[model samples]
Target: MLAGKRILLIIGGGIAAYKSLDLIRRLRERGAAVTPVLTRAGAEFVTPLSVSALAGEKVFTDLFDLTDEAEMGHIQLSRSADLVVVAPATADLMAKMAHGHANDLASTLLMATDTQVLIAPAMNVRMWEHPATRRNLAQLLADGIRVVGPNAGDMACGEYGPGRLSEPLEIVAAIETALGQGSLTGKRILVTSGPTHEPIDPVRYIANRSSGAQGTAIAHALAALGAHVIFVTGPADVPPPQGVQVVRIETAQQMLQAVEAALPADAAVFAAAVADWRVASSSGSKIKKDAGRLPVLEFAENPDILATVSQRKADRPGLVVGFAAETDDVIANATAKRARKGCDWIVANDVSPATGIMGGTENAVHLITAHGREDWPRMSKQDVAARLATRIAQALG
Candidate 1:
């Protein structure tokens, strides 16, 4: 899809700038031309020579380059690309982009560009979570700017949170979505991911080992196929995919409400590992460790989100899919779940500790349908998501 496309690549100042080199190679390998624009501060991390070598073109810098400015180079450069991508979009650059500060070449080009823009943010965890950055992110999304990641991981600063630049392939996928090519074009899909936290006390909760990798991958695949995605996620270890409307929740009840609110979609995928039960009356304050005698806790069954959505009579999606993560009787239990939930399909998997499928990268699953079951080989979560997305597109058609 990217063949012959022109990508205006802007390198921002951050440790993640090194990833931009890999990004250029990935884009070029897929037949996209990259034009590199390095910020003055960005040059501190990645030299202009390396960027020029990867892009096989002259690097653009300095707003006052008399040679290029004589012909209004900035405007021409901005308008010439099919898409504008900013890797390692630092806090300063994001702030500049948000408030329309055009003192530098990179920000000036971003201000002048009419092409669709996608950014992969990278920064310290604190900076990324700051109110100012959050406000800027909101503004950018509101302006239709696409965002990929600042995926949570250990950072160069020895702190860990959501500030690492997305891997090169992930950025490539986001670029594909931004470019608007896919089988599920014009479709809107809902995906729920992660393990819901059922609060038992102010600081404790019932949860699972779900990392939400599969669900995140499914959302990414759907978006790459040109689907509008409403991602309702619990406290997921992984960040939500790019190009989706994210709704974060902490409990099954909240997840259900979020799903209902984002209803009237073309399809829905329930991949969250919601807690089956919660404390009937959780303490508002932290439960003291030395509270004399052992406190007895009453448990209440959590709401069944998948069943509610699947059984909805109004605003029901054309396709409703549920997941069955079992440690025993994987096939029998999942088949029974399909019959019980009334969902169109159930993706069954053995998430037994022995299988290591719960929080692992690879998954072996069974596709259970009204017709029959298809035993699939163990594969990476991303491959499974892509396959399922293709099936969904066919089903929708």
Candidate 2:
């Protein structure tokens, strides 16, 4: 996705500097040319030799070196890349960037750069939450500098919270979006996929024929357009897409919880084939069939995730989309569902046995909205996802 792109990577002082090694390799693997600028504090964590070897380019460290200055001036070097990225953006580094400080080679380049800037912050939990750091962050964001993550997890300081660097692949996804200048950049999208499994016993569960292909395609499409996708998915036949924050779940209730937790999104697409009912009293152990008699089971309605979110008075997404996988009366059923669920739109498709769409790749869908309905031609799931993504960008543009 980053083919032919130039990324000027500034490594800052922090434990996360080690991840920059993998970041360099990932960017190169995608055909991007990386130029490394290592800070003095960064050198304490990772050797310049290792960074240069991975980047396959010279590592710029000193701003006053006569040879380096003569070869490429600081201003030219800073503006040479398509984007400038600071990995392990420590508190000190962020402060300097916020205040336009140019003490070292890294900060100097950041201050001189005319290209787009993206930062991945990594610090102790306490440092990240400090009021001063928070102020600096607000300033950087106000200046339109893109920020990726300091995901919450166990930190090197033996503390846990939002201070870990995002994974390399996640950053790569963000890079793709930034380079694409996608319309949905900075938008947070929530997507649900796969068939939820409702447990009946320790060894048995009920599920549908959903493969999660469509939902995975949707998440990938949104991410490609620079949207941050929170992919809440059930166990499926296929793996979730890369470049997304994935929340794995098994039942309708769990999916609902995950979705609610990822709220305040700009938009949400509920595509999972969630079962309507679950075993009212699931057996802790396997149900024994010693006799020839069949066992009776009680069922209870599962939580209505779509309606719940659509009707939410707080943290409701600006645009809510629901899906109707119908066997009959495709458009009518879906249209009614759109009104019943109070969602802005409904993507309805026939999943009847005759249609072969339950687990199939292609889909012929009808889009139902307050304005009207649009019957779309049958197309590959990927194509459908692309179309939907474009429509979403238009709606939220």
- Worst 10-residue lDDT window, candidate 2: 172-181
Poorly placed runs, candidate 1 (over 4 Å)? 181-183, 186-397
Question: TM-score for all predictions?
Answer: 0.59, 0.56
Put down candidate 2 lDDT per residue, 1-397, tens digits, no spaces: 4779999999999899999999999899989999999999999999999999999999989999898789667888899999999998999999999999988898999988989999999999999999999999999999999888877889888999999987676577567666756889899999999999999998999999999999998998899788999999999888999999999999999999999999989999999999999999999999998687998999999999999999999799999999999998888899999999999999999999988888887788888889999887776676578668867887997
Model 2 spans with C-alpha error above 4 angstroms: 1-181
| Candidate 1's TM-score | 0.59
Task: Pull out the clashing pairs in model 2.
Answer: none
Q: What is the lDDT of candidate 2?
A: 0.91
**Local distance difference test, per candidate?**
0.91, 0.91
CA shift at 388, candidate 2, in angstroms? 0.2
Error of 1 at 205 (Å): 21
- Please give me the total number of clashing residue pairs in predicted model 1: 0
